[model samples]
Target: MPERASARRSSRSFAAFDWLSVLVAVLQPDGSVQYANAALEQMLGVSRRTLVGSDFSQYFTDPSLIQSAVAGTHSHDFAAVRFEAVLRRLHQDGIPVHVNLGVGELREHLVVELWPLEQQVRQDREERLLEQSQAHKELIRNLAHEIKNPLGGIRGAAQLLELELQSPELAEYTDVIVHEADRLQTLVDRLLAPHRHPHEVGDVNIHEVCERVRSLVLVEHPLGLKVLRDYDTSIPEFRGDRAQLIQAVLNIVQNAAQALAPRMAQGDACITLRTRVARQVTFGRQRYKLALELHVIDNGPGVPDAILDRIFYPLVSGREGGSGLGLTLAQTFVQQHHGLVECESVPGRTDFRILLPLP
Candidate 1:
């Protein structure tokens, strides 16, 4: 009767850990799982009943790492030791996690905690990107406003100079000044474009946006480029600005076409428009139950490693004579919809993915 009561007391004590978000487990000195929390079961993609009494160390990439940690308890060492290890899931690839092992005084059982290291690193990167976006917005707005009026004055002065100059040499210099001023004006307008318009929110069908961009791109590049569509038709309409999304996607496609000029001449260029539903997605520091993943993929030389990280920043481009505002504008529009644009590239493939919440 006393042993049964002790087991009942242990069961109740173990139940207290079921609600934790972190994966927690109580293990014996020999590495057998005495109790597995709900989070641990979820992480392992298995049932608590099956997880308990199993050799917990077997689920890790290096089982000896876990066994060694458990062996520390035999020496009466209670200090938590931390190490990084890979946890093997039932149906998924192993995920890198930071493990903490220490013996709890209450039951003298080893308490093990496992948290995904990837999660913390991803969160840190997102935070840095958010901070960079805010800084870029402030810098662009201030710089554009500062340069706008002077550009007007310079253009006007050059016109006056052209009228006064009788010599062809002086007139050519005035033309150059006027042309450069006009170019600067156009750039300033693009820099301030995001702040000028109010974001119009309405029902948006992602496929419709994709078709519009596809048609526009095909019209521009009629000869060698083929635009293909692979869309998930079940994606529901979401609340967003339709025109902004169209423009954002269009910019990405246009950039790809421009980069594919070499392959286009060879008659082998292709751009694919793909969309699907993403569940439990986290980006821009917020988690969504569902999000739409729209990809603009192209077969071209990838983004230069030198400027890949800053492609979304103002005036950064990998191509010659490229204005570099396309990606910046696309990123701004997506951000207005509470989404983010990310890119992955290799030698012959480049994918620009835009993530937006779905209704």
Candidate 2:
């Protein structure tokens, strides 16, 4: 082959390669920028020209952490190290970015894959939550079946026993059994409702859904809890189960509202509904064409730490005398539509992100 022909083929192969993946990239030794994907560009709000020649550490909040990751990665035999460091994107914006650094010698240069730290964490969290939700569903089904028959027989026997007793105090004890059995039945019905009913899918305007939830929640609270909407007007319609999605979103927002009960009494409660379009989102180990990001943010005392990890588990509740199936059912419906649900909580702010795959 001629020299010119060989060089042309090599150029074509390099051009076809996907260098910028879902994470950030910073060249080692000099810490120069090789390339960043659309995700980084959108995140930093900067052009390729400005970022190409500069050091990526300048954008991070802690330059030392990046240096440590780089040195630690190179000192070993190309082992990856995880770091939780915030990026000082600009003067005003400091976004918390988790990064995993790994060094690979490629074409005589040490290339570092700046894996955006949250992607992996979010995936693991979603998988665990899904498993918990499914397990809850299975447990509920079995428990309901097992308990219903026995409760029926007990209630009947109690009625017959009540007749035989004739003592007022003994009859009251039978009434207690009947009342408790009825309550259990009602609880089981609520748990099985989603699986029993078929979801109605159609083109849904997300703004309308937010508006409906906003009105409903505001009407219920009516005083301290403020429901604010921050919707993207350019967001297009997608195929979704309108009623189910409404209920899912409503559940999350309502939970936030309930969390704000104390804050509301103190005039510090505010709930925000934020919407944006996300392209090429991966969910359930599969990438989607498009995804809708809906965030429910609250300015209140965050979720209790005791139940934080198990919030999606059935019967796990933060509130007194509350059933903890809201987040679980919300997750199930979202996952059914090929999406992911995520939560970030702290002392004053709690955000629940719902990512629904687009049509």
Candidate 3:
């Protein structure tokens, strides 16, 4: 083929495949990458110039697997091959992915597609979590209603008994009952707050929300703790409840600040509020072209593994004396805005990501 014609053909091919959502790469018979699409470059966290001409096997944890898969593409025994393998990336941990390998008869080159299993699993998990959250909200609302009436009766009876008591010492016992009943009522009110309150929707600037939370966190931890802002100035205001969004962000930042108590004592506590615009986000089974991504990241000892999964559940607190309703309320508020909140934690790092659709 002529050099200029071949160059045009290659550019056209890459342009045609660049818009694909899945990772794709054209490989030579020897398993060297000839061309990588945009999605593949983003997935590998590298540029096309760097990814192209590299050995395809270097990207996978098990090089022999890709080699065999590429070899199978050339074999007459199989028309196409699919297998699971761990993809290794520079300066990052390996990601388990499913690969589809096939040989293209037109170009006489091997084409490979990569799909991260973790991403699929994460999506499935998010769907389930949304469903579970709905169910939990319903249950909590009903349970709160059931307990509310009885709680009122208990508190009234305790007050009546206190008035009837002959001795002050005996009256103290009824006082204790009254106080406990009041506490229970408060707890029930909190459990039912999201359902009872009307959502007040208005234009919401995510940076304003972060700023409010930052101010509140700093007020609580004035010394030794540093709160940093990493805002994407290009993100425009969206429709949401400003107060609710502020509360949601505040709850997350408060939890992160509390988690950083140990680090604060060591004078190294740091929390970051990062905002970005994410494209092509799917939340609650609805796809949005643009969405707001706000991250509340902290450097702490991390959430305990045992309670990490249930951290957003009501009454499931990892800290002593914690009501455990912060994240629950945060999740509820974000859900009301048709958004999603997700958490990822390790020993030294914890990140809470809130995704909200933008108009």
TM-scores for every candidate against the unseen true structure: 0.80, 0.73, 0.75
Q: For this target, which candidate reaches the highest TM-score against the unseen true structure?
A: 1
Residue-wise C-alpha lDDT for candidate 2, range 171-246, written one tens digit per residue: 8999999889888877877677778888788999989999999999999999877777888988889888989888
* RMSD of each candidate relative to the true structure: 4.7, 5.4, 5.3
Q: Each model's C-alpha lDDT?
A: 0.84, 0.75, 0.83
How close to the true structure is residue 270 of candidate 1, measured as C-alpha lDDT?
A: 99
**Order of models, best lDDT first:** 1, 3, 2
Which 10-residue window of candidate 2 scores lowest in summed lDDT? 11-20
lDDT computed for candidate 3: 0.83
Residue 318, model 2: Cα distance from true site in angstroms:
1.0
Model 1 segments beyond 4 Å from truth?
Answer: 1-58, 62-81, 93-113
TM-score winner, 1 or 2 = 1
Candidate 2 Cα misplacement greater than 4 A, ranges: 1-21, 24-114, 163-165, 266-268
Candidate 3's displacement at residue 241, Å, is: 0.8
lDDT of 1 at 266: 93
**Model 3: per-residue Cα lDDT at residue 302:** 91
